[model samples]
Target: MELALPTEILEDSRNKGVVTALYDALSRRDAEAIQQILAPDLEWWFHGPPSHQFLMHLLTGSNKDSSSPEFSFVPHSIAAFGPTVLAEGFDPARSIAWVHAWTVTDGIITQVREYFNTSLTVTRFSAAAGQSDCSIATLHCPSVWESSLPGRVGKSVPGLVLAI
Candidate 1:
């Protein structure tokens, strides 16, 4: 008899892939790939200094050109909890630190919360016990999670705390 992975595990793995591939595409400045991975009406939120909004500037730039990227967000560690994926990196020399919280839907990334030069801690709030029901919106039923981050082209996952 073969043992299959649980649905949540499969989803978590897939979500990790989607977010990882996005970084690869972004590094390559591949507009076509970025467009394919991101949803049209993507939701976004950012916290930190106004000057460190490199990702925002990149995303808002015209999609017409695959110009060289101004900065890189190469996360040292990436973790996926249900539909939410967190990537963190830090640069000590430049004093640059960041974290990205991504929400993926049906293999497409629908939302992202970005942070710069901030510490983040993700807490898990599960539903009442004995709950086995979960909807698409609440993919990981009984489990509501939140974050926290770090680092560089140099890889550092700083100030990111994941609570189970």
Candidate 2:
């Protein structure tokens, strides 16, 4: 049997509301709420080569710098991508941020692949604090899915599969 994809795009109002809730949770540094939206067996990866889990640790309040007295976060965008979602933004005063993520089951966030651009982070921070002229880099997903198929082994199967 083919597995059914589960997703409900609420009315734009409700959708925006959920996104707002997520943003509020992040602003408060509520790790639990953050984790609540992730898949348990998540396999987060980066544009670089680091494991997704490692990136998640850094984003999920498990960092030595997390406890620093000068950290802040602001989530600018959170949009759905089929079964996944992409969020990009930064702490207006720090060099930390992320990119794409996959939601596996039960609203649980599984893999959280982050891309930390220190320069962008600094620029955003300065802009937010009214002390700089830097434009923040927005988050975006590449066109990898449309041109590839995922196998049971999680490898990309090149072109789209034919119905034959």
- Please report the candidate that would top TM-score against the real structure: 1
- lDDT by candidate, in order shown: 0.77, 0.43
Model 1, global lDDT: 0.77
Listed per candidate, the RMSD to the true structure in angstroms reads: 6.6, 17.5
TM-score of 1: 0.74
Task: For candidate 2, list the clashing residue pairs, or say none.
Answer: 37-109, 38-108, 38-109, 39-108, 39-109, 39-110, 42-110, 44-52, 92-125
TM-scores, all models, native as reference: 0.74, 0.43
* Residue 47 C-alpha lDDT in model 2: 53
Looking at candidate 1, the ten consecutive residues that score lowest on lDDT are 143-152
Candidate 1 on 3-120: residue-level lDDT in tens? 9999999999999999999999998989899999999999998887776777877777743254544677788889998888989876666677788889999999999988776667
Regions of model 2 farther than 4 Å from truth: 1-22, 48-61, 65-70, 91-98, 118-164
lDDT of 2 by residue, 82-107 (tens): 34554555443433344433343344
Measured with C-alpha atoms, the lDDT of residue 70 in candidate 1 is: 63
